[model samples]
Target: MSGADFIDARAQGRHDWARTLGTVALTVAGVAVVLVPTRLLVLPWLQANGADMPEPLRSGLLALMAGLIFTGAMAGLFLGVRLLHGRSVRSLVTTAPRLRWGQTLLGFGLSGLLVGGLGWLLDPGAVKPLAEVDPRILGFSAMAMLVGFSIQAPAEEVVFRGYLLQVARRVFRSGAAAVVLSVALFTLAHLGYGLESALFSLTSAIGLTVCVLLLGGLEFAMGAHVANNLVVAFLFQDLSDANAPSAAGVDWTELAANIVVMGVLVATAAVLARRRVSP
Candidate 1:
């Protein structure tokens, strides 16, 4: 069989071509729609005109704007596919999510340890202050952060791995191509982070992209992304400055550790997937 034929065979029952195409179209439309109202109109308007706006108001507005953008993108993909491509809304909602919850949680725990543990190692002082927070406040923060990150991270996975990667796999006929595209876009989405941050994000995306492709699911990647961000937003207090091993840059030791941990987790997931496929 030809390469396209091979890929088509593999993805045959998994996704509908028309639906994937519709999702791509809507995702692009969502980007165009959100830019004007959210980015141009609200952000600058608030900063320039709302000098009296409290810090909380400013932060809340920004978060709302970001959430809107995220929601728009997801709606475009999910709704666009259903409306334009005539796909089932239920299937669209759950596409590309062959979740192995156990493996996914393992991946999350492993990556968290690597990332968080390294920060502790490189600067032993890093872990000290984390324990100083009030238990009640920390508990609230952890719950809030996890809920927020869960929304954002899964939407990201659906857009990139579930939608973009599937279409790319159809066109390129290689999982690697889909992975590369996904990783590049993933990094680009965080470009506001500057050079170092972007570099670190790119490295992180590669590791994640590989996990998604090899395991043929977004669950593990979603778990790892959420866990990593949660640690930064909740558990950790002080962060290193921009230059010396900041959040953006993945340390060599930790990066290696993530590879091992994520590798094992994905490998186990792949084995489970194979068993599921077997007669």
Candidate 2:
């Protein structure tokens, strides 16, 4: 199915304006509830005790905590889709009977190669070596990242490319408009990171949205997001480190590289999707 076909599938369920608005409101409340208490109560405790932990472990724990908060949002989305919209959560994922796992895995492999390879090629010093860290600590941190990002990335795709995209398509009645609105909202959500970060996010959102429309599902976008986060977090120097370059800093070379990578990934997805449907 194409993007229009995917959106048209919404007609199979109760996709009235009231239900769509309710889902959005409920999802926002769910995220706020998770974030507020965690920031107020849990983060301080972690900060106080985090000094005793190894640096890698401390960072990993923080990532895990942040990722876990999205569980509430995912729950709210699922509930809203099932109860309010009277549809299965699968409807938010794909028009097919089952998710195309091959596409998901392919997306991960291709994105991991492109991002990691181009990142190292563009700035060799940015890539971290595994041998620099203690083996045990590295192992634990890797595990934390794997679990945390696995949850976090897919949950995000579910919200933006999945639910929000469908809702936008229904409301706007135009695929191009829906894509633009979804990408804009996705970039806005990351604006706190700074203008440079938001620009990269805008590039990423456009590529991911293109993949969703071309491939007609969330799987590829979900996999690509997970790979992008994992590669950046594990291989590249820590962006969150106090000593690292400011997120606000503009590097034209890096920005250009990001655009190139996103363009290539979208093209790759388009080719693969076409091949799948070809005789």
Candidate 3:
């Protein structure tokens, strides 16, 4: 089936305004359930006692907690799909009976290569060397980042590109409308980072949405998102550092590079999709 047809067929039946609203509400509550307690209780406790802990250990713990919020979101989405929509969680991932791991891996490798290479070429100093890190803490921090982003990235994809996109397409009965709405929402989700950051997110969301429509699945988008974040976090920035600079703005050059990288990713997805359909 075509990607649009797959989305339409998957979203067919059982989708109504009420269920859609319920799913969104549940997702919010799910995030809150993890976020609220972490902010009010866990964070305070960590601040009080974390000073004595090793920096790497403390940072890893924080990453773990942050990652758990997405766990809650995924949980809520699965429950809502099962109960309200009477569909399996797998339906949100792909039209196929099983996930296309090869596509996902290809996306991860390609995006990581493009983003990491671009960042390195732009500012070689930005790349953190593993040898410079404290060997004792390196394993802990690396593992924590891997685990955290593994959940965090895929959860965002499941929520935005998978559920939201499919439902929006069904409701609007226009793939274009669905892509625009989902891209807007996705961009808004990053607005707190600043206009430049939001614009970058807009570019990324558009590319990812295109991947979903072309490949008829979330696997490629999920992998690409994960790789992009990992490349930024592990190489360019220290996520364990609370005082690390936010993505407030980027220079024109960086913005141009981001656009190019996104374009390449979308083009790659298009090529792959074409091959899949070709005899």
Candidate 4:
């Protein structure tokens, strides 16, 4: 059950292209509909009312709100795979002969270690000293963010690599094409963050897609993404500056470094995935 086999199996079946495309439309629309309650409505409410609360508590509230919103999309990915493609939900998850949860968890640990370490080494400015966080609040805030990222990471992986990659392959007939198209689409999904974030996202999408393609599933991508988010949101919790948009601009140096880091992640995952399948 290689990715190729999964794609071919779906393509050979009696499924309508229009219906598959409809699934894509529905999923994206669902995200927008969901954001109305989770982000659009709630974010302003938080800004107005949450300011009086402890900063850590405010942050934790936002994180929990985001997690619930993203989890909805993750569930949609499952339904989309089954109802639209007439394929098992598991097939879109992994093309490996069997699901490998151990390897997936390993991917999470490896990515968290490597990305967190490398980000600190390359840009000393990327992280603040842990001493800055109040010991009382840090533990709770971190837990809240961890829950948020856990749901957010798999949402992106499942939609971009798991669902759309399969569609891209059927339509384009090339893995490279699927990867490129999916990366571009994923970048567009970040349009609200402005150009820099949109472009920066492309690097990550490419890296994760490469990992998914090589590892025969989205597990490595999901793990890597979740860990990456934690590193940025936690370790990089700062004395100054933030990933939160203050202005719109692209930093080429930062973007290039991101690409290099992502490439390393994909290469590492490939090696690990290989070891797991070896006789």
Instruction: Pick the TM-score winner.
Output: 2
Whole-structure CA lDDT of model 3: 0.80
TM-score, candidate 2, is: 0.91
**TM-score leaderboard ranking:** 2, 3, 4, 1
lDDT of 1: 0.59
**Which stretch of 10 consecutive residues in model 1 shows the poorest summed lDDT?**
1-10
Query: Which candidate order results from sorting by lDDT in descending order?
Result: 2, 3, 4, 1
Tens digit of per-residue lDDT, candidate 4, span 209-249: 77876777877677778887777767764211234663537
Per-residue C-alpha lDDT of model 1 across residues 219-264, encoded as one tens digit per residue? 6777787777656544443221212435645456655554555565
Q: How many residue pairs of model 4 clash at the backbone?
A: 0
Give the per-residue lDDT digits (tens) of candidate 2, residues 91-149.
78887789889888887888889889889999998777667789999999878877877
What would the TM-scores of all predictions be? 0.67, 0.91, 0.89, 0.82
lDDT for 278 in candidate 4 is 89
Off by over 4 Å in 4: 1-3, 6-14, 25-33, 39-41, 50-57, 129-132, 191-195, 237-253, 276-279
Against the unseen true structure, what C-alpha lDDT does each candidate score? Answer: 0.59, 0.80, 0.80, 0.71
Best of the two (2, 4) by TM-score: 2
Which regions in candidate 1 have their CA more than 4 angstroms from the true location?
1-22, 28-68, 87-99, 127-136, 193-195, 237-279
Error of 1 at 171 (Å): 2.5
Clashing pairs in model 2?
none
